[model samples]
Target: MESGDLLLYKRAMFRLAHISDVHLGPLPAVTYRELASKRVVGYVNWQRHRRHFLHDGVIDAIVGDLKGACPDHLAVTGDLVNLALDGEIELARQWLETLGDPRDVSVVPGNHDAYVPGAFDKICRAWGPWMAGDGQADPVGRYTFPYMRVRGRVALIGISTARATAPFMANGFFGNGQARRLAALLDDAAGKGLCRVVMIHHPPVKGAVAQHKRLVGIGRFQQVVARHGAELVLHGHSHLPSLYWIGTAQKPVPVVGVAAAGQGMGGRNPPAQYNLFGIEGEAGQWRVHLERFGLVGAAVLPARIAELELAPHSAQVSLSPH
Candidate 1:
């Protein structure tokens, strides 16, 4: 191949980093009024348990390692705050700035982001730049789901599953409207020969989370993927490393999940981790290599724990122990 052809081929390759559930901590001081509603339950949870495991240092270490890897784009799958406090939301915004430019990072909201009746609006207002669609001016007041951002050969479709639930509940809703819009987006991205990477907070697969924390309308999500055929699906909220195959057996789409970005090693949940995806090739012949990096044992530094490759148009996954 000519030098230019080689350069073009290299350009076709994209590196995407995925992280979620930061639950950014040291929960800000709350007033009686602030903790009057669902925030009270979340605050108690954080004080009693969550604050111990979700560490800011772990989040920083993972982000530092991720930056060193130099991904083309980063996808944050939500729960950046503990109680959706005003201070927490602002803190998350500042953290995002350090992560990367809004143009280079895409984000979707998790259940914690909308912990109360009005928290979702505040989250959108604070993180609108990272969540906005391509060519869209800041969607500060009016945020919409299934936003599409095309970078190189990849089209990132961000879906918001964030919604306020009652006390002790952590469910997400994927309504029919979003499903229809997502199907359309997938079809359009496919037509344009772009790799469609759908990012959601709650895993769309069945039995991924507890019944109370599960994604409502998961079947509808499956139907959309079955009909429109996405290239890949990425999610968080399970706070564990997982892999599931959706779509037809002949043309399976990989649905991947990562551990919480702030969970310390040896916690009840898996330790802090993130996923690096190397995407190359073209439509129908797309190649994907996934590497999971995180803390292991008592080590402060992150290390690659798993590596896998997804065969194009098939459900075959070759995983190599790290």
Candidate 2:
């Protein structure tokens, strides 16, 4: 083994902080010009001057707990913004900057990041400073996903589920290039005896938005994953956590989803929650201890788990399909 490998192994208790769907900054009241339509925006307009669900307090608590947990690495699944607004991107940037390092943090863009026309190709570049430089591009921005960073043999594979879809579609998609590249990435990483963790903006399993089932063409992606196998898979578009086993001929990868750290409607679920995974063992022989950290009244409560085991975003734009 390498030098620092022992430290990670000896500790065998490093924290993996997972958070998604920030949806920062509310929408400003606009003039309809007709003078008839009033009362802010839509009937369920979540982005108003006032806080609807996700608020600053929620983020503050989450950030504090994240620091206290002392995670070795951080992964953000996506939906960093609410309406794909320009300001929202910067807002998300500030929130994420609180983390220790950019190299240790990995992210994938959700549907909202690309909701407006050419949002990904346009706005995401500006998010560079926050992430320490254009956030690791993939050849002419063809696929903006970042490669896995190895921390004591732990590999993080990030995928882009950000696509510009049709109106009334709150769905996500992954193209051909991304799928093929992802398959190869998994194979290579697995061969290296590295713990492979796949991160995306949408859930590869199902649920979240029903009816139209905008999960169009995830079958191939699933097939590739099953072919090579993964240790863990993570996402955050649904604003809820659903666990599943996506196994290949080689091994099984536990896929999980989490809610928005800033979203909590009348204390709907866990007010602005985030997940922490404590893993132990080697590449293919790893184990997970999943627990949650969230806001409790005014004090950030910690739902800590000691050497445990087990497993376990947003809206906008009518893209892909609803």
Candidate 3:
């Protein structure tokens, strides 16, 4: 090939690493005074169940493997703490520093991070830096939903579906307020010839999670995609590996969910894992290589999972029911 052809043939690639549901462990000592609200029940639940499934060793192994690959950016989809206690939030901040700088790591909270009625405020205050909206004024130190972070030609959009539910529910909500803003954001990103990637805590597909833990107003979320369109969507909180398609104006948007980053053996949850996406090509023709890394035996390693091809814009599309 000639020099000019060689230059044109070179692929411009960007790597993004996605992990969620870390549930950073060894909970801080909690006194009875702090458990007055719904946290009392959550504290008991953590002591009984969460300690067994979420292992710090598993997180260490996964992080080690991810760092070896050296992704351009890391997207953490929350559940950083078990009960959203003050001490837990503070510890999570310190732990996030280990992953990378605040600018290099983007985060969105989960239901567990906002486990109680008023704990959301504490979470916002503690994790504000990691969740800031792109080029938006956040004088109040609270992050607004649908935050956009542009890396190369890919646009990483973070949306929060986290909310404090009742004693037995782990539900998430994406209200009308967020939905309106999301449509505009996605449209703008697409107009600029950028690949739009929507990241949220809960899966947006119908029946993705159980009734008690489902994302309320998922139809609104779908409608926005149907109108504006996005290339990909990443989420956590199902604690399982999943790939589903949502309809958009051009092509179906691939929505992916990952297992817990700290899950170990002997549990209903899948083992600890994270996803790496290799994205190349321009807005009209994009190629994504999705790879999953997990503990095959006692060692964590990488494995190729799926190869996705998205068609150019101007293609006819329909509304996907699920």
Candidate 4:
């Protein structure tokens, strides 16, 4: 059944907590061999700048506050580690444990998590359970990108745009391969009467980021959504609170970008904030109540943003598929 044909319940509700770009700090020591590739540039930048902005205490306070709210599920949009070092991945694993159990958390990788060639594979191995699909587990319990996990009436789809890039570039790509699979996945989930949420690290809209840090194949990603459609899109690469609309088969999908969860207040960078979304309403008329929580003084508290109605409006014009 197509999503348009499904009958959705009016009061069915789900609460989700979204935090991204943690960039978990104080990168571990790297050997000369590790810095041979792109690590050298990242290392230099971290030492000179990132170390101060991405604070451990800030993230701890933010997580502590999130736990107090206790949403139904947690979605981390990536950049958990700065360098993707062996130790960094392990450290992120321990941090994930602190956030929540694998069963309650869904994660997707970011450009920083796959900063080097072999680091992508390393992330898959270490963060497998967090990104696993809804299907039966493999004998080895391995994971693949664009994985889907169905939680109650919602289907959380995880897509990876995190691939190693040359120095000075913080870009991501959703190639034709992932695009095709994503379209099918969205359709399947929608047909099952699920509220589809696409989780990716990079924004799928053109000009969303600098040329060197943008999602390279955003056109392909947009095309897939235009054909299949989704209820909500959650991403984290820009490190700013943002809301954009993308054209889909039945409506304009709302793509939300969150600020870096661990960032401190002293710079041009946005302060640490996480998004809370209350999803409710029935088929064809879903509503997402959005609340942004940020660091103020020593406390992480609610910064009520806006409540959004996500379904396509009757008189709303369709967005171009650029």
Q: Top model by lDDT, which number? A: 1
Model 3 bad stretches (over 4 Å) = 1-11, 140-143, 300-322
Ranking by lDDT: 1, 4, 3, 2
Provide backbone clash counts, one per model.
0, 10, 0, 1
Better-scoring candidate (TM-score), 1 or 2: 1
**Which window of ten consecutive residues has the lowest lDDT sum in model 4?**
313-322
TM-score result, candidate 3: 0.89
List, residue by residue over 253-288, the lDDT tens digit for candidate 1. 899989999998656888889999999889888888
Runs of candidate 4 exceeding 4 Å displacement: 1-12, 139-143, 248-250, 297-322
Worst lDDT window (10 residues) for model 2?
A: 313-322
Candidate 3 global CA lDDT score: 0.81
Per-residue lDDT tens digits for candidate 3, residues 119-176, read 7788877888788867767731323787888888988888888888988899889988
Instruction: Flag the better candidate by lDDT, 1 or 3.
Output: 1
Whose TM-score is higher: candidate 2's or candidate 3's? 3
Task: Quantify all predictions' global Cα lDDT against the true fold.
Answer: 0.88, 0.65, 0.81, 0.82
Error of 2 at 188 (Å): 1.4
Query: Highest TM-score, which number?
Result: 1
Global lDDT of model 2? 0.65
The alpha-carbon lDDT assigned to residue 227 of candidate 3 equals 83
